[model samples]
Target: MAVTRWIAVAASVLSLGTLFVAPPDAPMKKTDAFLDAETTGVLGIEATECFDDPAYSRMANDRVVIYRPCEESADNQAFGFVYAPDGAFDRPAVAALGWDRCGAAFGKLWRGGSAEGLDFYPVLPTAETWADGDRALMCVVYRPGGKLPGSVLPLAN
Candidate 1:
């Protein structure tokens, strides 16, 4: 009878442990360092504007750290902030930095692995040459149907 009781106790413990298991479907979130809004936004027009503007003839020592919100790897400083106008002209230019570029403004990651997130960054651009990591300011980032992150977590897991 003692042996039977021990077996029953063992089974109860095992069953209880299953409660802590991860759910079948859940969203994942991560945190990392990114550029502050003030500098990145200011440099958009002040540093990259036409040469005639006074904002273009200033110092190049500002610290900018725009992190493409949708990138898997955020270890790029060399790709830093490249400035450009926020108009129709810069739309393709900003896209040239790639969908994963940090200065993508309010762009978010897509939930589906095969789709691109919306780009909500706003441009105050009247410039051509931007300082590294500098781009126009974006207002907001929203997922389609209100259901996704800036970059969808890769489905490889």
Candidate 2:
């Protein structure tokens, strides 16, 4: 399935509140490092670090996103955050919004250079979190193959 379709389907499923059940231990705290990560900090995520699958998956599930410094490899490299408009958690819509935002940011970052091997994706919020007032969309840039060695941001010549 296309990424947008998959995101829509996942959003629909999560809206139903059924796939993942919270563990019976302590209630998850919002202050967890992942949950409390600021946009500035997230923007620093690069080839130096990456988000594991569990963390990347949680991005759409309204859960804290765990990240680790890239040792040998990683799933995705976070590069920035997009401020999604305040509204219901509509995955496809938010994804589009995020893409638009990321596109502009990417243009500024790359100065119109070709992003031939790189692609951008958004980590959007779940309906529950939307209702509870989460409006940030994490944006990431990654190569199709796998892990990167250093920051993806283009440097001045």
Best by TM-score: 2
CA shift at 5, candidate 1, in angstroms? 1.5
C-alpha lDDT of residue 117 in model 1: 36
lDDT (tens digit, per residue) of candidate 1 on 19-106: 9887664322211112224434334422212111012223545544333334332221121243444444453455444334443422
- Candidate 2 local Cα displacement, residue 90, angstroms: 3.1
- What clash pairs does model 2 have? none
Q: What local distance difference test score does each model get?
A: 0.36, 0.59
Which ten-residue region of model 1 has the weakest summed lDDT?
Answer: 47-56
TM-score of each: 0.27, 0.54
C-alpha lDDT of candidate 2 relative to the true structure: 0.59
